[model samples]
Target: MKILVVDDDPMVLEVLKHSLAHSGYDDVTVAQSAVEASQIIAKANPAFECFLLDMSMPEIEGDDLCYWVRQLPQYASTPILMVTALANKRDIDRAFAAGASDYITKPIDMSDFGMRIQQIDRKNSQNAFKAPASISLLDKQDQEPDRIDFSKPVHLGEITGEVDLASLENYLLQLSRKGIEGLSAFAFTIADAAKFHFVCTTEEYLDILKSTGQIISDHLAASGFFLSYAGSGSFVGVGQNANLHHDEWEKTERSIQEALAKVAVPSSLGLPSKIQVFSGVPLRLNGKYAERSLDILYRTIVEAEDRCGDTSWAQV
Candidate 1:
């Protein structure tokens, strides 16, 4: 993970480079101006994982530089840190509006700087997010266990990890991040994660699903989306944010058409497959949509066999 330090002051730049090096981050790049920073960013390909920008540069003010960084495809999602002496609320808001992820008021307190770096490093860790505690379900007789509760928050980042082909057990453990309810619109493609049989067997795939379900509730938190699963290949997710009314459903159908046409799935098993997404409003609970707010993603295997055409696979 590379960190780009952008500031016009040569002495400040040198100090930052030296300080960060002392702090054990070796891949630091310094840029004297926003123009130079942009050039470095472009040539750096893959982009820097994080950026620390000095807000007082004349070539491009820090806030403006942040805005430009947000405009670039590679840096749009990258974590950006703004360094400034300005502690005004208005300036902080502007930095956020300009797409800065976090800000540091300068005069560079070494202790605070170290703490901020630690915080960002934690966020960057794949396992930083933790799943919420398990809720107890009551039984039919209201005795021990069996009653279900469906109200809870869903956090996506918790379960995602670096995918590895050599480890199936670890991969499944990582997938515990997703609650069963959130996967209602889910679809996946087998990637042969353990290299089992080159193409995963249905039984083995079912085992993986069953094991993951033990961790969280199955079925989605809400309804109105279709799900498909790919085992061992590539997982795809699709979601619909539409209504059942004729007009809304038609719009959703059109959206699916465009999504299917434009959606690009990765090449797997030497074949090109695309995921399909359909959207619809889940059944109203107290007249409101719930935590499954983001569109669910679906993965595809064969085109015709797994195409999520114009219908809901199962209602929530």
Candidate 2:
């Protein structure tokens, strides 16, 4: 549904955006600061079904944002999901006191993230959850078989200036330095391009992803990647998940758009928002030749650029 993801860290925002996108909720808006987030919310009234906010932010805190949101005449009952690194009871209690509907710790789990979102959706639902299938909120998309090559290193070719390339690089370096076991996910801040961008080998890194999903989600939310989008409102995603075919990948991307469509927002701004999914052939991830992986992603981005063809999200 129409949810606002507020975070200051660009990398975390990307991760959360990706996480939610993966979860099938596509209409996600991100705001780096609470002020910008408020502007979007006021503009899109009676929409923004939920808010995934970071507990800490510059100028405004997540708790304060929750309080402000609760005070909004149209959002008196809106759900606010707090993303926090601290699991202290007092901190959670403070969030609740400020009007948070739920709180997820720094490291968020995919299963837990799904369950929490489902719970929130159920609560917002008019009737009680009848059955698994009856809960239609979950978008219907075929799950792709996990196919990732992890025997070698990954590639990270030329980092785009639009993305937090440095942060990503540092994160990868830390992973290599401390070793994957000791280091956790990396966080970053950059201009809003999309929600998140990640590079990993599926077959070998599946457990790593699952194990770090929670932490990744948490860091993203806590940093502000989970905030609402204050940019043009259009998202361009390019990736090659070796496990998914071109058509299957398109379907998966469509599911995200469909999910975001469910959120009803004010059309006055005419924000032409759409999810464009592109795919290419699979490649090897030698880890050492990380450029190969980046090449796949870069090609996808280039394709998106050609298709975007002066069509801005603001016009939609």
Candidate 3:
């Protein structure tokens, strides 16, 4: 795949170029800064297929550059991995909020970097999602969208702080058990959303998803959190839990429910008048029985979904 690498550091740029070639991705382009990257993008013959951007720069920081790239229709759904510092929690969160697909830490590890690229390539082989040509009609007549893939994660566009599901998983995989010490993961799911999906128009269903995603980011707003909406009417996230008490998650759940209550979701399609949102216990990332980030990530998702024979119900 054609690739673009943006970093102000000359050595880092050369190292990344060599690494990509090692992984058999030789069609790589290099840019020293955001302005240079923009210039290259505007005049390219065949558009670059992927982007590797440093999260920090002297001016026009990486997050801002990511936002600029996402605004372009063609690259909206393309892979844009960030190169970040493991200790910079706030910057990592900003990158995700700005629509970065995934990130690799600085002081790059040569051995593992190739594995990350291979993972991305596998998905591309599966025909990763591409941006739609145009917006869907907003009228009530909007038919329900194509079958809701319970396992697939859809894009929530610019407003929702959405990170790709695979990207989120890759982030977790990159962390060591100790690296996850201060973080926790949670899931937010709409009760009986499948019923709503079948009855609501395409616009309404998407609106439900957009609203759920917005509420997750708005209510659970944190400087170190990143969220992903995995299908089945849910968003799963990992964030800094130092400031959030166990009880705080319950409150956030209630807040989300209260916020969702005001939307007046149309009931004509065999849907409930009011929808309820639920949160499973936040799984502490470094807790006992969670020896690996991937394992703990799924455990949190299961807890949020309350599908492991836990008691949970809609309050509305």
Highest lDDT model number: 3
lDDT by residue (tens digit), candidate 2, 10-102? 888998999889888898999998999989988895578889999889998888888898766556556678886756545654666565666
lDDT of 3 at 297: 73
Off by over 4 Å in 3: 84-87, 128-145, 158-160, 175-180, 221-223, 242-248, 287-291, 307-316
Candidate 3, residues 156-224: lDDT per residue as tens digits?
A: 654355677866775555444225457777787777777676677666777888787887688884546
Residue 240, candidate 1: alpha-carbon lDDT: 29
Root-mean-square deviation of candidate 2: 20.7
Error of 2 at 93 (Å): 1.7
Worst 10 residues of 3 by lDDT: 307-316
lDDT of 3: 0.73
Q: Which candidate wins on TM-score?
A: 3
RMSD of each: 16.7, 20.7, 4.2
> Model 1 over residues 1-316: C-alpha lDDT tens digits?
5899998889888877887887788889999999998888888965687899988788579889888987675554566778777665456546655656666776787777777666666656653363222222343675543212111111111122211111121112112222222222332222222332223343332333333322112223323322222332233333223233547544544544444444333333632243333333322211122222231221122322234341222111
